[model samples]
Each structure stands twice: as C-alpha cells, then as structure tokens.
Target: MAHFDSNFIMSRILLTDEPTQIGCVYLEAGGIIGFHQALSAQLLLVVHGPASVRCDSESEVCVSVGDAVFWEKGEWHETKTETGLMAIVIESEALNPTKYMPVKLIKD
Candidate 1:
C-alpha cells in the first residue's frame, strides 16, 4: 500500500454549478451503447478494463483505464466493449474538460 505524508489532502474545486447528471456505467462483454446524439456535453472516463469509442463518422478508437472521452452537445457518438468495462459518465451543459485536462491528439 502507498502512503501520503499528510493525513489529509486539499481538494480543488472544479465545477460550481449543478451538473445535469453524473453516474457510473457498466458495459458487459459484447455490449454496445448505440449511436446517438449527445443531449448535453458529455465525458466518459474509463475506470476499468477496455472499450471502444467513436464519434460521428470517425473510426472507432480503443480506450482503456484512465482514458477520457469527451463529446460535445448534439454530437453523435457510441461506446462498446468486447470484454466488459466500467466508466464514469458526466453530462452537463457547463462541462468543460479542456480547462482541467490536456487534449489527446489522434494521428490519422
């Protein structure tokens, strides 16, 4: 087990406004979240295992633990896993991940 020097660590606040929803999602093997438009800005953070994600007509991209995928409101997207996975999904009109995380550029 790892240990921290301090007994307590201060946490920085990110969002102040109430978000539409924040929830955990579990995708079973061979499961798929069908293609659909995002009603609000959405962020999906993979917490366990691996999965594939696609936005609009782009090619599907593989994502594993610690990967974060963001989709803007009204954008078409889909997610699926062949071996099951768990993720945290955050949806909000005020969501802005760029402010806190660096962008991951994908080479064509």
Candidate 2:
C-alpha cells in the first residue's frame, strides 16, 4: 500500500507501481516547476491557494483551494503560481509506446 503525510513541509509522495503512479506535491508561494509532457494521464488535486493551469488551445483554469483537474497524456501543459498552491498529481499509463519509459515519475 502507498502512503503519504505532508503536514510538516512541502513534499511529494509517489505511490503505486510502473505505468500507474500517484503523486502528492506541495508548493509554496510563487512556486512552480513543470512544463514537460507526460506519458500518461495526470489528475491534479489542489489543497491550498488558488492555482492556474494552461493547456493547448484551452483557456486557463483557475482552481481554488479545493478543486481538481484532469489532463491528458501528450498534451503540452504548464502550471503557474497565483497564490501559494499545493497539489497532488497522479499519472496513469500511456496509450502508445516508444515514449518515455520506466513508466514512472522517477527518472534514473
């Protein structure tokens, strides 16, 4: 079973096996870092301040402290800071092959 606890500091917790990883990330004020395409679907859960997300051809969505968003694989996307945002990002397997492997979030 996978588990996590972010009551102390901003952190991340990775769960599940290959091709199906769940993550929980915490961010402080104006903290953001993600512009790469994923090999799988991503589900984001906001736990703190307001967060903004932009997708190809789609208007940015401002998620409140208790909102969630779903992103498809291979869809170029970027997240920005608005108000100290904290979230949980989960990824699923890719539909096609020959893409980034390890099927995991951890790159080695």
Winner by lDDT:
1
Q: Give each model's whole-structure lDDT.
A: 0.86, 0.63
For residue 11, model 1's alpha carbon misses the true position, in angstroms, by 9.3
Model 2 lDDT-worst window of ten: 98-107
Candidate 1 lands at a TM-score of: 0.85
Query: Candidate 1 vs. truth: CA RMSD?
Result: 3.4
Residues 1-108, candidate 1, lDDT per residue (tens digit)? 236655765322148475579889998999999999999999898999899999888998999998889899999999999999999898999888778777886534
Which ten residues in a row are the worst by lDDT in model 1? 5-14
Where model 1 places Cα greater than 4 Å from the true spot, the runs are 1-4, 7-14
| Candidate 2 displacement at residue 76 in angstroms | 0.9
